[model samples]
Target: MTDFETLGAFYLGKRYDMPSRARRDDYVLYDAKDLTTHAVIIGMTGSGKTGLGVGLLEEALIDKVPVIAVDPKGDLGNLALRFPALGASDFRPWVDPQQATNAGMTADQFAAQQADLWKNGLAGWGQDGARIQRYHDAADITIYTPGSTAGRPLSLLKAFDAPPAAVRDDAEALQERVNATTTSLLALLGIDADPISSREHILVANLLHHAWREGRSLDLAGLIGGIQSPPFTTVGVMPLDTVFPPKDRMTLAMQLNNLLAAPGFQTWMQGEPLDTATLLYDPNGKPRGSVISIAHLNDAERMFFMTLLLSDILAWVRTQPGTGSLRAILYIDELFGYMPPVTNPPSKVLLLTLLKQARAFGLGVVLATQNPVDLDYRGLSNTGTWFIGRLQTERDKMRVMEGLEGVSGGQPFDKGAMEQTIAGLGKRVFLLHSVHEPAPITFETRWTLSYLAGPMTREQIRSVTALAPAPAPTAALASAPALSTAATGGGFASLDARAAVAPVLPPDVPQYFLPPTRDGALLYNPVVLGLADVSFANAKLGVTEQRRVILMSSVDDGPIALEWDAAERVELEPSALEQRPHDGAAFGALPPVATKARNY
Candidate 1:
């Protein structure tokens, strides 16, 4: 039996004895680290799968672990709404007036009753106000809408950079990039990727490969241009003209160009590039909880963003140092079409890749689906944990049983008893199965610290994300002087001068500070440089301790702290900073304060 005192073990709920109206305080605890091998949560509609997912996320937040939850149904955005005071006023907006009247109470009364219920229930589970407050303080939640402006909008237009070091060769990396980009573009164009024999696929893939080899990054516009005019005369020894013909290539490119110029599609081009470093960690180097809601997007748009996001995450994973313990989680709430049994959606390939390899890098993937009958269990054999809730159909139950058996790895499964337990499960109840446990157990899910608000509107999402705190500067650069002084000579002047006089940096060098903004603010943009530059600059400036540095972005409403690798690089626009008066301080005369960097 797993020890309850182990780290990451949290109270999930008490065990449920069937056919009894009474309940015992046989508390059931789950070890969060067990999720390193991946987990599955299955149930029918109204079966509390969402509640179970929210509970697990709450546990992760309490443990200070980072999470990236893909919420296709928009319900997970509730992770942002916390009732720290446990007041009814916080619950009133979500309560239905008619439902309250039917229940013989006013809306306010019903809301108060619901609040009390949650409070008492949480108290029973040992999660009182103080403990819940700790969870709130530890978690920094952001709700992102990919194709909507309600939350932080995402731009899927970043350059397809070099592959991770794990990739064997440039040729192999190019092929992977070509495959991913082609699939995404095809999805955008409402076509399927058939790189083997399709003329359009052949033309686009070669164009991407040519641009990549030439160290040229192509956005949507550039891609159209490349297609209109072939970068190379030949494609795989056959003349490009003979294979795709100029007119055919223009026709294909124009189709994509029209899609790009569409008003509804413009949202895809706005906002910062999706950076996993920023998604997973805060400026203070703490783990963050990020909820990406794609419920409002169309099917094609969702697929496009999902493919790119997964590919980016895989690249990020490859950059990390290997670890045996759980480092982060990637949760997909509705895995209906992404990992269906027979259909080969682009996301399925990436999902399977993560399922098989992400564990080695300490990335746990939790997939939840109400439609269990359609899931491809063979691809999910790597999942070791299963949380089974009530299923509506016998077919779904049988499918879940078969999936359980497949993943059991020879462990004995009591199908008949398991079916009975599942069928009898009530709301907020589920069966917990794990290889780490001796046997599967049934338990109720604990109350979530976040209010279970229904799906939020774009305006509501925007309001929540707007209140998020700015990213903090990394510890190494924490005490660095303000961007203005740091760049000119208060401390880093010599280093800046040296860089200016040095030969042009190679494209492979990941760090380079941008020119001073028009307002004269020296923005330490992480998008332009790597962490090593910050470290090198800190050492050159002879700073020893951590200090905070503010990073200003024209695209954001306010300045954010330099969040290490998570900061998105945007085109430096002419700012009011350039119109400000310049200080006449010259080289070789360092201020006394520069010698001692002050901590923020």
Candidate 2:
């Protein structure tokens, strides 16, 4: 027999004897560390898939592992409802009077009886109030609503900003950023992000790449400006006018600008910036349970947020030092179109990348879905554990079996036995097949510490998140240096002032140069001007210099610090040197100049 105690296992319910129709004394256990290979939970709507997910999360919390749960249906908010001292009073609000009457008891009586049942059930599973309290103490929970203010809203407006310290010199990294940003923006605009076919996507990608190389981070407004007056006059061998005419560029910018100015879309611009470090841990160094609820969002909103979030997580994972221990877990409650078999969405690509690479970084992804047929088995093969609950249809069962067989890795699979086990599963019962185990085991899920209150209302969600303390600033933010432009001897002259007295530009010179405004101000760098204002404003806003610098950390820190133009030095405080849009020059104008600047 395997010694679960030594393996740091989570105790599920006892094994079920199919022939005897009874649960055996042998407790089924899942290895906490084995989760590095990832897992999947599959079942029909009423088959208790959510219960199993809650149970898994509870166990992970108990083990002090951080969790990022994507809740599309909003049921996962129940995690905030802790019932350490379960009593009639604790259950009365959740119990229905008519249901109690049907059960031949008053509501209070029924509540009392249910409380006893839960107490005994937890005791049977070797969990007590002390243990449950410990789990709560170890983990902090926050519910995030991406496009709603009901809970903590997530700002996706600056989601496409360049990451701190990512090497711009790396072609692969640059292309990935461009592709992700372009695709995400297109998805937000309700447009398909086919890089090769969509002219809008291509133009956006070109502009993004150009801006990134210039060391500028564009918010929604900045992105719109870039599209309209692109920094580069030529994209490849063709002129910018020939590739995407000024009229077309303005139209594209207007579409995005409209989205930015929309009232409903403003929710995407509020709240804290999504940082993986804060999502995974709190200020006190305790693990956190972050529930990002997208239940109210439409398909386009969900796609946009999910794509950027996953990309951010991937970037963060690359920075972590691999420990080989389970550092974090990502649980997406519904994985339908995000990992479809036939089509590749931006979210799907990032998800697949995580599935393949996150294990090395100690990040485990758990995907649960009612619709198993929609998933890509090839991508799912990367997952090592499968929790198969009851299926409503034969097709779903068959699809799950195929997925199982694919991941079995040539090991003998007893398909008939698996089919029987899956079919015979009762409510809250599941068949757990793990690559770490020699065979599959059937077990009922344990009682959850959090009450299963169904889907929470907006008010309930807000209350839960409000009670939770805000997460500490991310490590990246804490460690990043405040960015400032090198101070010139003249105490920071405005770009306009510098451009006015600058030498006249040659006719053949392409407009749009990178950082450092010279005497003629003819050579303008949007990156230098924008960043200087950003840094100064951030300093005045009480945001730490480090945090402000971290905002622009996506650029390779070394080159940025060493190569910054002295003439465009950043002022810590607001000064006359601050470039203001003078004479209707779009803030931080890029003058046409022929120099060693790289052209997109």
- Measured with C-alpha atoms, the lDDT of residue 378 in candidate 1 is 98
Ten contiguous residues with the weakest lDDT in model 2? 548-557
Give the Cα lDDT of each candidate: 0.72, 0.73
User: Which candidate should be chosen as best, given TM-score against the real structure?
Assistant: 2
Candidate 2 C-alpha error for residue 217, in Å: 2.3
Best by lDDT: 2
Model 1: worst 10 consecutive residues (lDDT sum): 498-507
In order of appearance, the predictions have TM-scores of 0.75, 0.77
lDDT of 2 by residue, 208-261 (tens): 777677666666666765676666778778898887877677677767867876
Candidate 2 displacement at residue 85 in angstroms = 1.6
Q: Which parts of model 2 have CA positions greater than 4 angstroms off?
A: 1-7, 91-114, 164-170, 213-215, 470-600
